[model samples]
Target chain A: MEFILQNLNAQTGSFLAILGAAFGFFLAAMGSSKGVGLAGEAAAGVVSEDPGKFVPCMVLQAMPSTQAIYGFIITIMILGKINANLSLEHGFILLFAALPIGFVGFLSAIYQGRVAAAGINMVAKRPEEMVKGIILASMVEVFAIFALLISILLINNVG
Target chain B: MSKKNETNFLYAVAKIKAIENRLLDKSKIERMLDAYTPEDALKVITEADYGYSVSEVSDAHIYEVLLEEEMQKTIKLLSDISPQKEIFDIFMQKNDYHNVKVLLKAEFLGIEKDENLVETGAIELRKMKMSVKERSFIDFPPILRQAINDSLDTFGRTNDPQSIDLILDQACYKQMLESAKSLNNDFVTGLVKALIDTVNIKMFMRLRALKKNWDFAQRVLLKGGSIDTDVYINNLESPVDSVIELLRYTSYGNVCESGIEDFKNTGSVAALEKLCDNYIMGYVKKAKYLSMGMAPLIAYYVAKETEIKNVRIVMTGKINKLPNEQIKERLRDLYV
Candidate 1:
């Protein structure tokens, strides 16, 4: 009975760590997909009218993709710590570590997408204002970066 | 596929924003007005998107043809690009109603006035003509068909052509209001109401100038305006000063003050018409700030119409060899 309980704990601990990585990756990736999709729609509208504006629109549409990268970095760091002997306590800590990035990255990407889309429309009307739009879109990335920092710090303390 | 963004007009609005730069403005019109010859004035418009190839330009006298083609092109562009096309019905239906009026009048009077029919209505001119000729109302909107029947019955009894204008004009507003309400959009609804008020004001002043009876004016007045119908009715017998006083506090105060003064002084609705156009332009200028939805498209349409009207005014003055100041005085405000 003792050996079986120990085996179950080992399996659950590994499962929990992998689940945290999955949450961090998929949630943020889904947000990026949403963000890119929204900005892409507005970008296509601009490009259709004036193909010369394709470069600026392309830059604006790419702004939301960084959140996914942040989530991915945390996800990889969590996975690097995985092993057969990982305790349930460490599993819970890893899971908690993933939560901030998962939630923040997901929301920030979607909201950033909305801003980028609006910016793309602005750039269409006044092509010279493309820099202003890019700067506005990057503001949403700050919170996402902070979440990534805390997530990495938590993963480092898992030992 | 994922549900599309809530801003369904994103594509159309963005394209229109780019296209709007090509619209004629004050300086463009000034160039046309200041040009030495009629053809030179024509040259000014040719540079804009009047939907005419340079080879198609035959003569300045036929600038009307160019204007007509541009109107058709504008209608096609809006209908083709807009996702919420039904919202435009409120505007395009005016042409449909105009076509019906022309066909009905021609049938009644046995006159050949084909030039009165335009090709730019929401419904095709041919369709409206056939429906009017055959007495079929199936293809028409509910209020419009009923207006036709009512106008026909009233004409049969009274043998008056003016009744047709009254019934059709009122029905036009009713149909416009219906379409506006169905959209549930505040901007469009407010625009339609403003239009009704302006039309009512114009009709009241004209009927007053003609010395028409109060009862006739009341009957002809449209139902859906911000101002009450009785305001016109009660003031029908009063002098123009009291009417001006009554409307002084309304949003149309400037229009009434200037339009009524011009009407009283010159006995021409020309100034009044110009002021009303500018007032509507003022109303639509609000759409310039909006980056989404159908506001910009509608604003562009109004802007183009005003541009076309000014072009016609300039061309007429140029051909007649009138002074530039006179042409400038007659010109409506520019949208850009």
Candidate 2:
């Protein structure tokens, strides 16, 4: 075990760690980018249609950020492993565990953003109850957050 | 999947983007709001080319058109590229549930048969409405009734119309999730699960307001959803505290804090529900930017629905001569 650990230590282990974090961040960030982009576009449209709804529509359009946050959590974990004393196998486990959130977060954020954008448009049309539109769009975020949180918790405690 | 089929997802995303471009923006909404009367608003809506043409516009007419356009756009997007058959099936199942509820409500209230159905599905609404009126879920067309039996069955002994709706929604969500699970498609699963959680929260609020027994609430509550069942159940038993705890601990904590306060007030169901809408919009905005799949589609649908509801609310308020400030307070937070 010591020999294996010594050999593993001799190798460039940070590559895997950094790769995992970057992958997680990039995957999740790309997903969020698509989602937020859709939402922002929708918000812009809604703003153009009804400027009074700026605040409500803007807030609802921000719901897609959870995916990136989850990615950030994974990136943090991978960094911790890279900087600290850990075995290679343990490092791999941490990396693999982070993939679900990164990928799931990415996908969830995209769809959720469209929904938010749509809701923002709704707010622009009916600025009076912008709050209601926000709630409707925010409802889908629970799942992305759940997926991301589980990934974070698993990476933090398990590996 | 063929090479062409492989790009279906991308194609669908692009198509959605195109559709997104057609929607009315905030300034348009403001313009409509500033109009002198509902007639003026109707003229504005018509001029915007919202895909409706009527000889004379009424509030109900505008409502119908807006909803029809939304459904039409959704179908058009879905049709451009057949996604995983299962995902398509799941989305159709939701429409099926909506049709059922509409049919049931119309029937119970003795509404005019042909007046209420929205024409947006593969099946003709007139034919579906007639078939549904006959009280025959089994004899209904295959496409229309595919997963509906399971949904209806979930209502087993419950006589409450709302409970029936709740059961069907839960069942539809369950089946949808099961189908999504089979695909191993994280995007579809996450989007569907988020939808389920939203439905569950709505049902939970309704049950809380009704003060139904724990068992009844459990029966209506969806199992194996993104939400923790135990936590949801606990929240039902003591909505104010449990809900607060869940909100405080979960990812939705920050956004839902105000909703928790609304629940505390109990008299503030409207405010609480508004908070819930805001929370949902916030969450979806986050999800859409992270991934480029059904999240954006689903979020768009939700926002559209909220928009419809808000318009209806505003029109109603206008008709009733409610104060603008009061109307504003009742409006759900819009996600621009």
Candidate 3:
């Protein structure tokens, strides 16, 4: 792929880096949206019956958005790494760097959303257990944090 | 295939979980049972948000009115929230078939029995009655249409009301199985099969008591249950104890044991009916752990149905001045 990109244009290094940023931003955001959609649907169901539960339900529903934030941070890092003299190898490195958060954030957020939705159901049944449900849903965020850490290290190593 | 359908009921399932809190518990059942008057017993259910508002119904004696109102409300709410509206057709279809039977019997006897008809069904009651009366079923489901025709033809030959019941009951299960298969859901199909099995088991026991012949038993036992005809057909002449022993290892072993033991002692089928209902309730209790699926919705429906039935039992027992133990024996398990 690098060879093909190089042959197509002698100077495609920064373009690849920009592509990496797009991947990190878009894939993670898409995942976060889907996660939020699922959790939001469940939250609405709970809140419909008991309006007082809106706060707890909202907390659980918003848990998946951290994946999008991770994606955003990686996108910014990739954009910062771009320069006129950036080599094609370095461009490839940045593109590969974006992948850890892009793919992982995408999948993790969706799965985390499902967990949060279940948590919302738990809160609906026993309001006192809202904290327990939030803690359970937070377990899924550990993987997203690992993906974010890997993406940060890879971006730092891009030089 | 069913995995995909499981995700569709998320909203309804979660909402049902919330609504489940209002369902009667053991304490509530006890309160209803111990109420001083039948009107006070009626108060227990009315306070739980059952049926139409209390203001609309002036008399407590019309408990059937409140029960019917609750059923209609539950069906409407579930259908409105469900992604697939016809998901509820399996339960509602039974009412339609029942209405059909009542209408057909009335026609055969040259009498009108509107009071015996249940108000809730997938099809409008009036339309179903008119269609049955006119022998026009173009808009009706094909299985039901054919079943009605077969029942008419069979009745013509036998000149017996029993044949009409046998034909309709068989068709009810056949159509339930068909609809469950159409949904491509094992949970639903299994539920329908379990229902058929209970009915088959109860009918077989009743037939054995009556010393019914092989042909009659075959006609009475409906198809589509996991248990085959041979199980009942083979044991037609066996003594009641041995029949229960033979069925000792099946899934229904406990049910048959408890139900038959009760039958042996009381010489009445009422306890068997309660045991069969308990068996179904036990089957549906699996849905409690499921957070997102059609199982919870189905469970909720069964739970509400059981709740209504238990309340009816308590109301009747209290009204008749029966003892508490009798009422407790008749009560089904609580869903909560």
Candidate 4:
């Protein structure tokens, strides 16, 4: 235990923690960027047809990326536990766990972004009936939220 | 790949094509027209494949079911293509208006609260009821409240029925323009601008029929549309004898020329409004085809909504046992 502690000191472990968080943030942000960008394209197209529909569509598009922010929080948690007796391998394993959340969350969010954007277009055309579009777009975010929750839970448990 | 897996557009188009087969055709409309009572109409509608049980349905139910299915297909086609939530929100913005109106009307008229309004727009029924009960639009989001407030004076000041409607129309147009400008998308901005232009033309004719002050008419005319407002205004007050009046020439001259003629013949603004809706629907269909990607989707949505409006008109007409000719006249021509 002492040997392990000395080897995994403040320097190496702190660097690993920073690296882990950075990677997690990178993965999550990349997903959000793609998702938001794709959604924006669809929203713009719908707005072109009917400008009144921008708000709800934008809210739906932005909801999925909330996971990426959750991923950031997890990374911050990992960094705080830098010298708190975290095995480098355990820390690394936890870091990888964080990656899937960001990767899957980002991909899922992108698809949802598209759905939400299209949903916006639907709203633009049928202002009389927009609940259906909002519901359909929201359904896409369920899986992404689940993915994010699991990653955050895992990170919390690790600390 | 069989026709199903060929291309997303082909697939969507094919699916829509197949679904169109299930829609109520002309013959069905004829049959519906012949139905004497609401029960008979309901039975005829049930036979149509709109993906819902039409039997035991109310006038609003048929509208809701058809709107839902079309919305589903729209979302299906659009889900993987692009993110257009903001655009969708713009369409839903009217729901907020609808909801607000229902609330206000119910409170003012002492009408029973029906859940029907919930199926209409984005606002939750509970919240909508609360806002209505509160007699204040403040509980809504700032944008919603602003939109509601913007139209209040129009709703309040108009004593004439047609003039009362003009307030809502003007408010809708103004909100749409403001919303479009806020988005910063040239395509959307252009489409919205054109829509406003067409709508303004229609409004101009209506005001003229009412013999309104030209300055008041000018106040309602939104600037930055595709057509020049000054030219349109000059033409609005022009005599019928000078048909070749260069100032009066517009892309909308064809459909609206008839309305202008009708305006002279009967002086009814309703006909002009109907012509405007029909012309705008035609322009939207043309624009959708001209622009690809989400433009088609937007077009499809607009087409579907117009179709729903048409359907509603037919259903309402049928329920009231009105003549088919009158219903047909009220229907907006769609790309279907």
Candidate 5:
């Protein structure tokens, strides 16, 4: 444990900043993958019965993917902020700022995926109600959006 | 259940939702009832994507063929996609028991295989027949083998075909309860208990009507049902009204009261049986809104079974030229 802590302290601030960016991107991407995978599975079931429903089913499946994009944007912002002379404190601040989106995106994406998967059933049974299902699923996006906003604001304010 | 296994039903449940749309609704059933002739009824059924070629043949025999085919299709589809095959097998196990009873009865009677033997059992009808014919119990499941051996032994002693049904019926419920318990799903276990309770009540009412002895009633009574054995046995000598009064405290109390009223008014137990079926259907219908898990799949399977049963009832009534009102009275509630 002492050796690990010594190595971490010896590492450049840019390296710590890169780790923060990686966390933001990787965690959010993971959450999106899980959410989209869940929704895709349900979409496949709908498409198997009626291939004509592919368009709407795909739309429902794509809803959970927004969090990954948000994660990527935060990662890019953090990458842009990193510099050769960046201080360890600034790097740590950026790393802590990444937490909101990392954890929230991870959780919200999974739950959103569940909602989107449930929405796929509406498309299967009643095509006309597809819009309603999508809107209902989108309700889960609010938390992910809030997390993304907080992450962006936090990353921008970091010295 | 494992987390992985729980999530595995997303696709299965979605597919079930799609299939649920094709199930016959109450209005469609009413249309079949209102049809002018059996041929017209067949048209409605064909439009619903069932019995398509069989309807062209227009033979009553083909109707059973169509029903069996539909049942086979449902069982196949569900078995293929279900996360837990054994849970779906609970429904098919009864048919297996039915086949066992038929095969054993045929063997004892020195007769040919009955055409009424349904092929929808978890164990294939042909395989069960072969096992019975060869007098080998190795191929059968433990519960099934034990049931066959016990029924065979009883039949061998008394040479009474009736004893075969009694023994097999008891074994069938016992197996169903065991399977349900193993699945550890509350809905399934509750359903099995409800079924046993229905059978017990039906037997009690029938025996009371026939003025059968307590020993005969006790002989046919199955244990492990929700209703206490003593509740049924204690009411053995009581009047039907008192039996129903005692039942009023149970889940099926209201249905029993109405069924008895219908019986008194019409001199038939058809209403009682229909009520029992509808009660089960009503319980299963709660699963319709569930988007995840095994509930929707089980619900759809039960809905399809009820639809097939209603279709059979409708077609048979039309063939027999029963009045529309009479036919309608006999119809079970639609799950749609």
Candidate 6:
């Protein structure tokens, strides 16, 4: 454990900053992929029977993808904070900032995908009721949005 | 029951949801019941997308062929989508048992293949026939092979065909319970238990009506139902009213009570049979809200079967010129 800690300490601040940005982007993207994939499967079934429903089905499938974009923005912000004089403490703070969105976005996106997949059923049965289904699925995104907001706030406050 | 298997049903469940809208509602059934003639009834059915031609509808055999074809198509669709085919195989197992009864009876009567044999069983009708003819069950599952042997032995000893049905019915429920348990699904298990209870109740009522002895009732009653065997045995000597009172605390008490009343008024057991089917449909109707899982799939299959049964009842009633009210009384509840 001491050896690992000493090695981590020996690494440059840019390396740690890069690691934080990678975590934020990769974890959120993975979560979004899972969520969208599940919703896409359901949408394909609906569209197979009725091709006209492709638009609404696609909308539901795309709802979980926002987390990935949020993750990408956090990644860009973390990269911007990396400098030649970047200290270990500031790099660690950025890493901690990335953790909130990375973990929360990952979990919430998957659950939201489940909700969106269920919503696809609603759209399949009642096309006019697609708005209601979208609203219900969007309810799961509140936590992911909060995490993104906190991530941005934390990265912005990093000196 | 891995996570992958659970998630694999999303597409199938979505497709089922869309298809569920096409199921016959009460209003359509009422329209069919209101039709004045068989041809008019056929028109109602054909217009509802049952895919039967006028001539096919006119011929009773052809109509049955169409219904069986539709049932096969539905089963095939489910089997194609399901990660675990055994869940649907449980439903097909009933048809296998039905074929067993037919084959055993045919063999005992020294007859050729019976045309009444349904071909939708998990085991093909031809293979089952071959197994019965050769007196070997090499290709059959253990539970089914044992059932065939036991039924044939009982028939051989007593030379009574009725024992075949009794023995096979018990074996069928036992196998269904085993299948449900293997899937580790609570909903399917509960549905099978309800089915066993209904079968037991139907048998009890029939035996009671016949003034049969306790030993005979004991022989016909099935185990693995929610009701205790002793309850049925003790109630054998009692009147139907006492039996109803005893069942009042059970899950199916109300259905049993209404069935008894209908039996009294009509002097026919058909009303009770309809109630039993409706009870099962009512139980599975709860799965409609489930977004993903085997429950909705199982429920959809049951609903489709119920729809076919109702269509058959209506078509037969129309051909026989039975009264509308009588036909209406016999129709089980529609899933929609």
Give candidates' CA RMSD values in order. Answer: 2.9, 15.2, 2.2, 14.2, 2.8, 2.8
List the TM-score for candidate 1's chain B.
0.95
Please report how far candidate 5 places residue A16 from its true position, in Å. 3.2
Q: List the residue pairs that clash in candidate 1.
A: none
- Model 6: residues with Cα > 4 Å off, grouped in runs: A1-11, B1-4, B51-61, B264-266
CA lDDT, candidate 4, residue B12 = 34
CA-lDDT, candidates in order = 0.87, 0.64, 0.88, 0.60, 0.84, 0.85
Candidate 1 deviant stretches above 4 angstroms: A1-10, A87-93, A153-157, B1-6, B52-54, B238-242, B264-267
- Residue range A72-125, candidate 4, lDDT tens digits: 786777776666566666666566657766677667766666665555545544
Each model's TM-score for chain A is: 0.97, 0.84, 0.93, 0.79, 0.91, 0.92
The digit string of per-residue lDDT tens for model 2 on B212-320 reads 8888777778776677766677777664666767757665565356765776676446765676676666665653442234445555555666666676666666666
* Steric clash pairs (candidate 5): none
**lDDT (10s digit) by residue, model 5, range A1-159:** 987665565466678888889999899999999999999988988888888889999999999899899899989999999875677777887897788888899988988888898899888989988999889888989999999999988888866
Candidate maximizing TM-score: 3
Find the 10 residues in a row with the least total lDDT in model 1 chain B. B1-10
DockQ (model 5, Cα) = 0.70
Instruction: Tell me the docking grade of candidate 4.
Output: incorrect
lDDT of model 6, residue B324: 90
lDDT of 4 by residue, B205-243 (tens): 666667777677776776668776786577666765464
lDDT of 6 by residue, B1-336 (tens): 555666788888888887788888888888878888766766666676664344556654356766777788789888887767889878899999999888888878888667778878999877877887788888787888898899888988999999998889889988998988898888899999999899888888788778899888877898898898789888887877888888988989888899988776776788788889999999999988777778889999999999989988998998899999888877888888
lDDT over C-alpha atoms for residue A64 of model 5:
89
The ten-residue window of minimal lDDT in model 6 chain A covers A4-13
In model 3, the Cα lDDT at residue B160 comes to 94
Candidate 3, residues A14-128, lDDT tens digits: the string is: 8889999999989999999989988898888888888899999999999999999999999999999998778878888889999999999999998998899888889888999
Interface RMSD of 5: 0.8
The regions of model 3 sitting more than 4 angstroms off are: A1-10, B2-4
DockQ of each: 0.54, 0.03, 0.70, 0.02, 0.70, 0.70
| Per-residue C-alpha lDDT of model 1 across residues A23-121, encoded as one tens digit per residue | 998899999998888788778877887899999999999999998999899889999999999988888889889988999999999889888888887
